[model samples]
Target chain A: MTDTRNLGSQTSLPTKKLKFHKPKIGTAIFLTVWSIYVLIPFVIMFNIATMTPHEALQPFAFGWDEGIQFKAFSELFVDLCMGFTIFGAFLNTLMYSIPPVFIGITVGTMAAYAQSKLTWHGRDFTFGYLMFCWLMPDCVGMGAGYMWFDFLGWTGTPLPFMIPGMFCGVAQVFFLKSFMSTIPNDLLAAAKVDGLGDVMVFWKIVFPLTLPAYWCQIIFAFIGAYNNYLGPLIYLEDPATYSLQLALRFFSVFNKDNKPAVMAGNILAVIPLLIVYLCFQDFILKGINMGSGLKL
Target chain B: MEAENVEALEGVQAEIVERQRKRRKTVKIIKQDIIGWLMGGWPFIGAMIFGFIPSIIGYVLPFMELHTFDYSQMEFVGFKNFEWLLFNERSMFWLALKNSLYYTVSVPIYLGIALFVAVQLDKHIKGTGAFRVIMFLPTFVSSVAMSIFWQFMFDKTGGFNSILGLFGVAPIDFLDDELWFMPSVIFTGTWGACANSVLFQAALANVDISMKEAARIDGATERQTFWKITFPMISPTTFFQMLTSLVGALQVFTSLQLMARTDTGPNGAAVSVVLYMYNMAYQWTGPDYGLGMAGACGLMYQTVLVILTLIIFKTKKRWVHDND
Candidate 1:
């Protein structure tokens, strides 16, 4: 969008004016190769999912001769069960992912609103505290979280994953806070003059206004919970309660001979996220930019 | 006299109403403050319980001999676990530490490649948006799935070897060979470089075009202008990217876990610190919580070092131009 024609025109020096130019062939070739490299995994995943085991070993066959074997998906859903089927794992992933996102967003929105809109004592301190919590890696807490869950007799249940999620989503709080800070103070003041209390004003004015940011937060939280492996691996002893990610690992381990089935499980585990990325690509990109754009 | 009395009564009524209004306003302000506290207080409390308490416990757990989950059984053992990890010649901890630090080499490789690609993509190009999406697609895939995909590709009879076969080159065992294993892992790590590249592209777009043009008019070459004008303008973003990439590299686990099948592959070359800690805590011959806590403590020290380094870089922010 920068006008390259007028770019060097302002300078007194007699130089050639810069002009917007098409991407050279070399650039196109480089990007094409990079794009192929990036996409090779998905391509391989799909190809192997359709292939018979013998054909899969060939490494080049697409299994198109058999015309796209949908049987692998059926097998993933129906045949594979160490204790529970992949369908059950999918449902379990949803259960673990959705409620936490819901709770996290609700809690995050409230905290962000309070930090950005409401004036109170200890507000800045609390915001800083949340930021500190955000900075610490999540894995550092795994050992203690496991023990804490064990103490509360909550291990082998979804509570270990969901309970902590309800309380401490510092990332969500930070993202939503940054977005909320952009809202004009006069808008909230006008709402206050109309007899709207702080809570009502947040609910009516702030929440709706920051819905785009919420969407970004929701996608990120959902993807995180859905793809989480370590949390379930450490805390949940019950095979029946494993999320799709954990289940996929087990599926590959247990069904080592069935490469097609393992590939099918992999594809199934990634499909929801793939769909999310494809649909909300712009929002996801914006979220990544916003996150990176944050000053320390 | 009657009219004057009426005016006097009206004035008194107005005063009463105004006073009542003032009192109501005060109460409403009080109520709003209470609401603010109610809304804001829960998250902080939750953070304390879930975030702060656990982190504090994680720090202290290293110093305590945790025989079992029971707090009553835990005994204080100052620096004993650390001594075992650091001083004991037979500890896998040293090898794991070395491998973990080595894995950080991917940070620069990834960033350098990403910055290069991003710079190229920043030019006027057709279908750049589509190209960006294609490039970024791999990052959205789950790490486990991608690891599996990579494992298949790196298999002895996999596509990579098959492609090499066409060139009459001998097949190499990418995962099993000691020399090749870490590079394979680093290669897999670079697959997610698109995420960083996209971020770099955004940063590049935000650089001041006017400054770039002025440099051009001053007869500076393209490379010099980029280095002198564009790079410094985006230094803050570069710093952020470096910090995140380093932090991420330090905690590299999933690919190693999946590719190595939870065993450190090929001379313990693929064992990251987190994966080592995970094994110590859960997959050890027994649950050695103290040793695992020691690993966590070590990770904390590393994190602190990273933060300190970041702070030092932040102090040099004078070079970063704020074109806003």
Candidate 2:
């Protein structure tokens, strides 16, 4: 437990332990003003999504004379989105996102363990290489990314995303390495003396110690994969291959100027992500929102 | 003769023991290497293949003059592609270059605001956690959705303008005006700035309260204590946040595209290096000589980033407050 307490500082949790005192009205005022700025967009989104099409002309009115209508939500499912529904888009997004992250998590844990626990001749050099890999192919031009992947016979395929995302998770490895390194080396040495091999030590001791860290990376990976737009836009031009983001983008374009429906589709597109966040908020919110740095 | 034979046998046995030890060391080296490779090497290879190979290809392709992306027919053209990007009237490279820098200019401002807000939130204020959640909500929402919402807000008769109109100010077409388009994009960025505040919140928590108490006991004023101690304490994380966000800001794509709700904003004001690269590759249907050109411009942008990052790192010792 003492070993795991370092997790708090390593990831930098700034909650619960800190003492608090009564703040003045100025703190209340400033926080409220900022909170409005943060949350007003969500309010506007919900307003537009539930508004009648006529009232949507004044989308920011925040009034509902005809009351809130769920019609746009239904219509978004039925006739909006060209031919695809939000659920289908969600599935397509899952196909593109979830598997790579699941695989990346396991791979990242192993890589992180090896990085922090193992000794090899060029281990630090390998760490440097992984950090270099973290520079990522984001700098790859859309045309060049396409052409390069096409040259490899992977253009218009999921392989481009899956291949890179699953393996090029050096950021997660770097993050998890920080967590894994905090586990005392003496524990592993003692385990080894008791006949536990590296693999067994990892499985029996290191993994459980670092389990919470995995969820953090997994959430990061899932959101990253879910929100990926340009990758699919360049590689998956076919409507069938579109990720949720690409699908919503094209859905609005394909549908004939139905503002409320588009707004509703936007709302639907964000639901699963919000659910994922809420589910993992306990662990992640504690950890300084590593997300703010990793992506944001 | 008997004594000499015994000594020779003992020497032979010692040599055999040495050989066995050498073989065991060799086996141990191979085993450790194998374990390292098994755990981490495969993913490292995948990273190299998918990351470095494409990047190197992208780097090399720009120097060739090929109508098709095909390499066999590509003729080496030196810097012709770069010359086109710089000199071509039709190219939007300069606008993208300008816009990329303009977007990054908000980093310090937001980070400053974040640090200030973090100090306030670090107090035992009720709902600070809730405030943090609200601030980070934008991260969960896709940029597409955020853009669409902001697009309406920045509309001529939309939320912001209407509020302005109540004060008798005339409406400005934020998305269509070149002056306002980039500003509107920057405005959308303000909402996302809260994300950094969350990070700073953690950084503030990690600062040494004891140091602050010591400063106060020494008769330091609150502001003086903050500037002299707390600020320096958080400077490393601040530097880190600045580095990562600058990289992210340079790659700002979705907002510029989706907010203006155009392929390019008014008079190409919203075009980013990545967006322009997308245009060169995807928009024209003919032979993709533009592909190489896209590669050229992208390389220029990355080179600038690399240089800029190196410069920032070089300057780190001056401001980053290493806790030695």
Kindly list the interface RMSD, in angstroms, of each predicted candidate in the order they appear. Answer: 3.8, 7.6
Which lDDT tens digits does candidate 2 get at residues B1-324?
Answer: 999999999999999999999999999988988998888775678766776687788888789776655667778889998998898887778888889889988888788888878888887577777776776677788887777677767877678887888888888888899888887788788777776677888778877776776555545567887898888878878888888888988888777777655678788888988888777766654543467877887888888888888788789888777664
lDDT by residue (tens digit), candidate 2, A211-262: 8888888887888888887777778756666677887777666652466777
TM-score of each: 0.89, 0.91
* Clashes found in each candidate (C-alpha, N, C closer than 3 A): 0, 0
lDDT of 1 by residue, B1-324 (tens): 999999999999999999999999898777767877778766788888777777776777777776455568777878777776667675677788788888888988999889988987887578888888877776668888888888878888887888898898899999998889988989987888866788888889888787787667666678888887788778877877887777777778887888884477888877777887777776765444444454454555457555755675677556465545
DockQ of each: 0.43, 0.33
In candidate 2, list every pair of residues with a backbone clash: none
Error of 1 at A294 (Å): 1.3
Considering only chain B, report the TM-score of each candidate against the true chain B: 0.83, 0.91
Name the top lDDT candidate: 1
Sliding window of 10 residues with minimal summed lDDT for model 2 chain A: A1-10
Listed per model, the TM-scores of chain A against the true chain A are 0.88, 0.83
Superposed model 2: Cα runs more than 4 Å off:
A1-23, A79-83, A135-138, A289-296, B68-73, B285-289
Where does candidate 1 stray beyond 4 Å? A1-23, A59-68, A79-81, A137-139, A287-292, B1-30, B67-72, B286-315, B318-324
